[model samples]
Target: MATADPYGPVHTEGNAVPPLDPDLAGALDDLAGIHPGIDLIRDGIRHLALDRHTPDTTQTLLATLAGSSGADAITAIGHLIARLANADHNPALRGLPLDTQKQAQRHGEQAAFHLNDPTLHQPASEASAAITGT
Candidate 1:
């Protein structure tokens, strides 16, 4: 039988953090490595590609994740990184398809480059065009 989630819901401003999908997590881990700090870089990816948050969310989100949970929470972070990276920038191009895999890899590399200092609070938009190529 399926068990209930042990850590319960992860919330940021009442928004529940997305569940970790294994495929997404694997892709992210492949791109960003399995280091714990990889979790912090996720916010950068979100800001750069998805434009979901201010570039400064890294530390805040890291604190949120640190308090909310553990392995599962980190996994969720990795999943989000991969999901944003792998996202198709142009849905209309779905028929023909862009090299989204490459784009995702580019995003992952960009984020991982910042792994050394994820809390630096730099603007994440610098390489948005290069990473997403949109």
Candidate 2:
């Protein structure tokens, strides 16, 4: 007979959550190692998710991530940087007021600059390559 215990039902191996994508996980690890203020960035992500006050830099990066269609983390990040660098030239913002568009473009350029710092890019690229098996 099965015994009833005070604890809740036990989960078997079959019921466990699937493992994370290895490449994505590795890329995140690499980013953490290279980024100077990873903890702050994480906090910023959280704040943005929770609708709290987040810096424009954080918002721009997060928005890029949200809209990116790259096959891997590295490509996605690179694409985001590129997009931010050309923010003012994007056709999608044509409907917005010129001043508002300019402000957003400035924020995007600043975000790209910070993310493209050599200190972070080198390690992140190496990590991305490892994930892509290149």
Candidate 3:
């Protein structure tokens, strides 16, 4: 069973508040598996990356997507971050520290956090065994 936050819906702390319409939530969630050819993850809290989003913002986005279907919310969230990290102009996402980048590369379904930056990155799940010491 998934645990819901007492906050229920309206978000404020991280990024600007997200739209709370159930229909919008459902649509965004459906995008999870569509393979957004362009990655959506980024390091900052605005512009075209996921990093531009706050943890609460990300959570809100994921929760909305999770409500849509059988998709795994975690992975959906990860994909969004991956999209952002791979973006071309996100300063916060420029070359990352080797160790930190490695861990982000390891998240099979979840996001990897930059300990120093607190920004989320897409896990390098499939590219390298170096991440797993394999």
Candidate 4:
């Protein structure tokens, strides 16, 4: 099992940090494609946290979650939720029509619900156990 890349390679010299497992990396890529704003929001939060010089609970929690397989999906979903909510309040998003804003809000709510869904957080072994009643 590989680890998460906390410090993404700047020089691009074959990635200085350890890479995430192939499956997790692929899943993260797929999620980013589905929610285009997820990466933007994640990067923004990370930058802001670093700039503030204060404890970043969100970053810390996500890093901890990334330690395990499948947890990155939950973290990505959470970032999508945050992105939607942030866009809804941002002045730039105001330029969008009312219907578009409503759509974004709806997407955010849906993501939030998905984030709260218990099954999303369950490990495969745990899920299998529940299914088999073992």
By lDDT, the best candidate is 4
- Score each candidate by Cα lDDT: 0.47, 0.53, 0.42, 0.56
Show pairs that collide, candidate 2. none
TM-score of each model, paired residue for residue: 0.23, 0.34, 0.23, 0.39
Model 2, poorest ten-residue lDDT window? 63-72
Model 3, TM vs. native: 0.23
True lDDT of residue 47, candidate 4: 55
State each model's C-alpha RMSD to the native: 17.6, 14.1, 17.3, 12.4
- For candidate 3, the lDDT comes to 0.42
Which residue pairs collide in model 1, if any? Answer: none
Query: lDDT by residue for model 3 over 1-134, one digit each (tens)?
Result: 98898877555566364444577445555555555442242111123232355545545454343322224444455555655554243456557876665455454224423221212222322222233343
Q: Which should have the higher TM-score, number 2 or number 3?
A: 2
Q: What's the CA error at residue 116 for candidate 2, in Å? A: 1.0
Better of 3 and 4 by TM-score: 4
TM-score, candidate number 1: 0.23
lDDT score, residue 18, model 1?
52
